[model samples]
Target: MAHGEGSHNRNSVEAGLEARGAELTGRLIKVVLDGEALHRLSALQEADRTQAVADLEAENEFSPLSHPELESVLHLSIQEGRMVFDIRDSHETPLMAIVLAMGPFKMLIKDYQMLLDSYAGAIAEGREAKIQAIDMGRRGLHNEGAELMQARLEGKVMIDFPTARRLFTLVCALHQKL
Candidate 1:
């Protein structure tokens, strides 16, 4: 988990979220994920505070999680060694649970952790140059993950790239916890 220096990094990550959350935007009103599944995946869960901020950012999509009486929730979980996306509507109706094999993202998850570690180290050592480089890698990896997620959810859930990116970030958060 990120401590002192890491705190700054974490806040910057969600800084844009608070700024954007003031408005009623985006499709989902909330996203839910439990710790049981996360614990089952790994004993390396990040601090709850960091996890909450990540979840909040992902759910809010940097914008407020407000919309019409349309679909508004996605329940993320893991079952039978696979990832489950249990999406629900405003009335809490079952939309779809896009189940995906965890294998495909295995490498990405590993890379994500590496980047997080590298970022933390860079921050700790005050290596601004390294941090910038790591940030670029983070963005590229995020885009790649988003594209993969979109392809996997094809014909199932129709969401924009940014939404998919947020969802993928959510997935990364889950990976940290996932």
Candidate 2:
């Protein structure tokens, strides 16, 4: 083959490849766009306003207590040996219905934080009457308590009688000097 002819043939092959690549790329882009459009349409259809309002009203009727108020309801449920359900069930008291129906996890977390604050306060006050060295020792102990409390808040620690008993002992012992 002639030198110029060889160069011309190579250029033609390269141009053909580029054209085919562009066409394939365009088709792939169109497929992605179609998928995204369908996803958006599905989301819009799912966001039905009337259904949302009805759901909101239903939830509201079940749980009239605010997030902060959930603790008392939980306590009541525990005392009564009742299993609380967010959905309608025969065993649900009005308090149980209200608490279980709202943002249960959020309210539980908020209540946990409040309880943690009280725990921290009890630790702080408990250490106040001790000598500085003993207080320091108690602070170290309290750091462990804090970590345990964090684990409890994260649902790693299950609330049980044994755990409560240990915690009560620690709190009582901490305050003895004060």
Candidate 3:
């Protein structure tokens, strides 16, 4: 059955192409915040702020499956009181750009700053119980922020909880710059 054999071969080729396409579109290879945004992050106190930025840079990854057309590299910035996401392909081609309002994130960022200050004070004074309590509150706020981000990006992009959290931190850092 030569015709049957040819059909099977075509099907296999199409499947292979689909798989490759999926692999390419599934994940972000890297993410970078704009320089001015990073300068804002630098304004944060020396130790913990630096560590948080490092953690975000090293560990954060995004899966933009909701918008399969998005590229592998992403550039983030804050402009005119809005968060800007520039999605780029592997060859540095611009794909999609999204801007989200910053109003919803304001209170969360303020709470995060307060928690950071309290945590630092507790650490300085060697208050273990207070440190744990403050840390719990900090995490709660962080989680809430992440959830809000996910909700905001609901139809625009697909990101996991951890990615949302790291992005939230970056957004807060950008707010300080503004």
| TM-score-better candidate, 1 vs 2 | 1
Each prediction's TM-score against the native?
Answer: 0.66, 0.21, 0.73
TM-score of 3: 0.73
| By lDDT: ranked, best first | 3, 1, 2
- Candidate 1: 10-residue stretch with minimal lDDT: 60-69
Residues 1-178 of candidate 1: C-alpha lDDT, one tens digit per residue:
1113233533553464457653224366667774454553322324532454465545543221232224367677666767787777767788656689988777876797688778888888999999999989987877777667666654444444566666666566566533
lDDT of 2 by residue, 42-121 (tens): 22222322233333323321111122112111111111221132222223333323122122223333333344445456
Model 3: ten consecutive residues of lowest lDDT: 1-10
Total backbone clashes of candidate 1, pairs 3 or more residues apart or in separate chains: 1
Q: Per-residue lDDT for 1-178 in model 3, tens only?
A: 1112333433454465467674313456666667464553433333444555566556654545444544477788888888898888777788778899988888898888777778878888999999999989977887888888877775566565676777787777667632
